[model samples]
Target: MTAGTKPVGTKTADAVVIGGGIMGASAAHFLARRGFGRVVLLEKGRLAGVSTGHSAAIVRTYYSNSITLELAKRALHMFENDRDLLGGDCGFRPIGFLLLIGERLRAAGEHILESERRHGLHVERLAVENVAELAPPLSLDGVSYGILEPRSGYADPTRTTENLVAAARPWGLEPRAGVAATGIRLHGNQAVAVETEDGTISTNVVVNAAGPWAGQVGAWLGLRYSLRWSRESDLLVEKPADFGELPVVSDPGLRVYLRPCGEDRIIAGLGAPKDIEPVDPDDCDPGLDPEMRERIERPLFERLPALSRARHLGGYASLYTITDDWHPIVGPEPGLEGYYAFFGGSGHGFKLGPPIGEALADVICGETPEIDLAPFRPGRFIDGEPLTSAWGEGNRG
Candidate 1:
């Protein structure tokens, strides 16, 4: 049977989540686990086929704000305990993460160190020598120091989304792949159902986790979200035979972040705090551009000199649905009773989606979430309380 076509004659559901990316899958999983009967997840395409699939799924807890730091910390826990918390193995690699601190980023790094420590997160301040000892492949030319998260690493985005949905299947979670939500049916000012190309499913609760297409989804309900789209890319190169294992490295000085993709390949991308390359989410090129490849590789070669002799293995591009504050807009929409806004991850949504979804599920069930999500309220933008970041105007929150 096609996804979401189960229980034979059911045309109704307790909740409907739009977009099958990590955010949507996560929301559906938690809602179903909470015993919200008949939770349906609607996807225009395959699960994690859009932005989530293309993400360089790095999971870390380094942030300047308490809300994000808490959310990220929860995410790390969920990933580490995936079988129990997330329903299955999420392909989490505990390869550690290293943030190279240079003169320009020392102050921000220090702030992150202080914030993370205050939250009781496991973080260490490593000097230049310590960094070199941790990753012998790195050059550390302009690096002043480093911040290390020993448990932070990357995960398989597609696998993570699939696992969440699979874990929730027994609890009445219906995943509707290849189904596009065209509009939201509202009674007065509240969402009542969702209209899709296949058919409409009557539901009281609706969560918008549409990633790059989120702005368009908001318009269906007369809601206007200030979202911008950027084309982000990541490239992989064949790892040298004797290069050995390396931790996920984020170098603000070189403006690049890289990690081991697998046993024989390394993946790299431009770090946050860079210029946003605006794009039409539907029309943006999925293949990495030649110029961008050069830009990403130049820094990769500088950091790990051995990679210069490695072969280019091509790369792909994807979209980052950005908000003005570089943070996700979560929680219930103000005037809409059963509608929730859960998109706009900026650039770091992959790692934050599941934990935020779990907390959002708690909020929807009229219970208090372990991590308060008040800071990410949808109306924060209009209230003139946009979140500030150490690296201003970038996705380094």
Candidate 2:
């Protein structure tokens, strides 16, 4: 784990993780607990120092795909009571989430509601009056309907990742920070170890959980994928001097979402046509401009008239690795034995980390996963399969 030491002969491990964010940390945690004792987790920087630290930490199960929805539901179950699985405080907040829909998507709203009900999600379809009664802040004149998830909420992504790493340490896993993966060592077309910037660690398998930089990692093994990175800025506005409780809210028509960070601050983000390519993952600006704020503020003001009283403190950029359909790229990579890639989660990975890690671990051990992973195969694109879906949030397959 030394920063500048010469590469040493690595002690073989059962599995090696290439990133230290929530995905890698949770994967390592599950692998060790599932009887994979020789596990090593490598982080290019400190654990949760990059995208995971800046995550909006929204936890919702409104996915259009059944596999992903099941994964989110399972992970939520673990997070809802982390004391049993993670063995410490994971900072899970139970604040509700309200998703506003426009007139054009009323059918989509009902379809999602019915699907949630079938899965026992307990979500309710709300009229404008019900929306106002639940949130009591937003202007609902333009909204046709809304969905209320009483069990959905947010969490502190950084703390959750660190807590998982801490829990795995006792199970004989080593999480080494400040080590960057430069390449992969292959034996008979299967990854056997990862060569880092400083040293090489020999292992039985490698898990590509690199978050925003996952595509670069995939290239190391010559596995072609469609993962691409983009930057979205969010304005963290300080609450007004007398601001009251504001639940986490999403407006699909406006492509914007906001949530209360604490008693005195609110976090806001948008997915719009103005999205831009990210320049650098580490140095991207975290501040939002007046024009961008206004773009988000206009719809927000209509939804929450009370937010007009708050002051904009600043904004920051969070990187997203989007695929053609925005569904996560999990499971094994095509033509690469002994390796699994998990990234391009779009913006939903934080809440799905626990289940993703568990599924990856199950694959490594030759066990059938609890949830079907047909929707996340890397070969989907090669076989002329479209990454098409109801939600147009495209990501690497």
Candidate 3:
């Protein structure tokens, strides 16, 4: 594995995960817990070193799709009881989640509320008064209605990834940090090995959970995984005295989303009518710019007028791995026996990772998955079955 000294000894494993972010960590965690022997997780850097570490980490359950909604519900369950499942704390803050839309989408809002109710998500339809009652600092100008999930909130992303890995340590989880996957070694239409920077692992299955770098990894196996990278930025400001405790709020009318960062701050980001702001995931400015901050703060100020007194401390940007359909590319790749494409979180992945990993691990371990993942198969795009959402916004899906 040194200079041209031959690859590190051919170590065999049941599965090789090529990223240590939340998705890869969760996948490896679940795979090991599902009894996959010798599960190896390869990370170029430390766990949650990239996007996961910078995630806003909002845990919301309202989604236009049933699969994502179900997974989100399950994720909430795990977050609420991490001690039982993950055996640790994720620092989940259940301050609730609110989604506000313009007057034009009132019908769509009600439809979504009914749809979510039918999907087992007990979300409440809130009028403007109710919205003000929840977050008193908000000015409901140009707002039509709101959807509230009382149990929804945010969590610590890095801790959740770490705890998931920790819980699976007793189940043969082999986490190889600082080892990057160079490529994939295929054998007759099947992924049989994972090529690393210093070694090659002989494995029947390889998960492309490389986050923003997943597109590059997918190309090694001749797989055309349609993925895009967006530089997602968020800023945290000092909580003004007048700004009361606010829930995670999504104001589609103003194209902004914000949540209480902690006791004394609020984190804000852009919402609908998004600017793609594509960038090279490996090399991009991580600092938030004034222009971007203005885009995030304008809508924020429009909704929460009282926050004008808050001071913008600082913020950073990270990559969002988006797919063609915005939904994650999961399950097996067509014509490939053992390769699984599981990246492209599209900014909403932080909360969805655990449930997705659980189901995908079930697939890899040949067990009955609690939820159906066929809609998320890599071949869905090619098979003309791309998933859709009422919002039709990339991340909202």
Local distance difference test, each candidate: 0.91, 0.77, 0.85
Off by over 4 Å in 2: 1-8, 271-283, 393-397
lDDT of 3 by residue, 89-174 (tens): 99998989998867877766777788778878779988889888887888888887789999999999999889988888899998
> Which candidate would rank higher by TM-score, 1 or 2?
1
lDDT of 1: 0.91
Clashes of each: 0, 15, 0
Q: Against the true structure, what is each candidate's TM-score?
A: 0.97, 0.92, 0.95
Q: Considering TM-score, which of the candidate structures 1 and 3 is the better prediction for this target?
A: 1
Candidate 1 backbone collisions, by pair:
none
TM-score leaderboard ranking:
1, 3, 2
Q: Which of the numbered candidates is closest to the native, going by highest TM-score?
A: 1
Off by more than 4 A, model 1: 1-10
lDDT of 2 by residue, 94-172 (tens): 7887878888767767777777788888788888888878776677766988888888888888889988888888787
Model 2 gets an lDDT of: 0.77
> For residues 1-63, could you state the per-residue lDDT of candidate 1 as single tens digits?
332333334379999999999999999999999998999999989999989998889999999
